[model samples]
Target: MSLKPSSRDWQRAIADARQGLSAWHVWNLLAMTDIRQRYKRSRVGPFWITLSMAAFVGGIGLVYSTLFKQDIRTYLPYLAVNYVVWTLIQGIIMDATGVFSSSGVYLRQEAMPKTLFAMRLIMRNLIMFAHNIIIIPLVFLLFGVWPDWEMLLAIPGMIMLLVAAYPVVMLIGMISTRFRDTPVIIQNVLQIAFFLTPIMWKVDQLGAAAPFVVGLNPFAIFLRIVAEPMNGRAPSLWTWGVAILVIVLLYAITGPLFARLRARIVYWL
Candidate 1:
């Protein structure tokens, strides 16, 4: 057996991605079913996710505003957007760790494209994201943040995020399958990152070192690309450059790794 992925493997992987994209009806049905199962018999159902986010944003935003001595008006909205985007990012990575492992029954039984699971994960989080994001407009309305055309810029940033998410989840999920400990390590790292990134705290508070901090954090980079636009500030050219470059590099890595591992992933389960 050869260790290297050949041209055929690359082609097959591309075909898998295409099939996954085309299997929209299947994955959307699967994703919605997962959501239904999770919230089964609940009164508010998925609105619990929205309410939970509202609680965190309201509670933490108020306290952190006092702690940081920032104005409540600006701070709350900032926190709302950052936390919402972060939740989507966080959810995707955490779910990715088990995207395949948890779907062992489905994968083992059907001749399904593995990318379909990845799509299902993305769809699931996006649905949750929709539920959570209503807090942003509510916070904005209370804080007097009227939306303008600039907010439309965030649409592209969101597009970039979705673009980055597929490879991010696929790569992480593959690695997590090979090494079971990856999920725990990732959880710890995300906790550390929550503190390290400028979610609750503004980056400018770091004084002269803010650039260096955000520059090094991929999370911060993606966060700024989306959250900044939503906050009515365009992300700097540096951020756009870094974000695009990160996607390019991420795809370059995920493509080959996934091609090699796609077939073996089911076996790992």
Candidate 2:
């Protein structure tokens, strides 16, 4: 015979799990502290990362634009924006994988919500993304890529992406806590995904196969959602619909698991 958690026990666990949102200030502060400490002695601080990314994007854009025979005016801006967005997505997924183990000290010392740690990780990455994004406007100016009203849509697209990130962080964070090797696996997969995604390449270049390659690729879908707006066009309805559908499915699967295993995280750590 086996015993299951009673309804009240489950309810309490869920409530406790959701409490992380209310503790946003705690996670936000912790994330800021991490940024400060990471660059404590450095003169340039986090902007060093921004400079590095700028150099990378510039170098890659020059080479790829030449190789692909694309106009520098068009290709450089496209590459710059897409690369920044990809970095944000990649960083979130990679960092989320270590959220629990990295916060083990706090988890052991207190009864705080596990999701708080995940939020901190996401917040840290968001801060980094913000810094790295400064180059986009410079690229825009260099390439004469001006934004229009459609650019406003990028705001919602970004919000949707961040909203989608929460469930992904929770799902990966939970699995990583248990498996330990999950982070390594996720990193390897992301490497493969990078090439498959249309970051340095254009979708139309693939011709007839573009639909299957770009449409089926979630990262591509995500890239289009944010990138199209910056390019002065609203993403197709299909893009928004697919993005929302994927997020809904992700939450449906991960939400229950998070609720069920929210307490087991401490032991796993």
Candidate 2 regions exceeding 4 Å error are: 1-6
The pairs that clash in candidate 1 are none
Stretch of 10 with least lDDT, candidate 2: 1-10
The residue pairs that clash in candidate 2, if any, are: none
Whole-model lDDT per candidate: 0.92, 0.88
lDDT of 2 by residue, 1-269 (tens): 12255566568667765798789899999999999999999999999989999999989988999999999899988888899999999999999898989899999999988778878988999999999999999999987777799989999999999888988999999899999889999999999989988899988899999888888888888888988888777888888999999999988888777767777889999
> What TM-score does candidate 1 reach?
0.97
Q: What is the lDDT of residue 191 in candidate 2?
A: 98
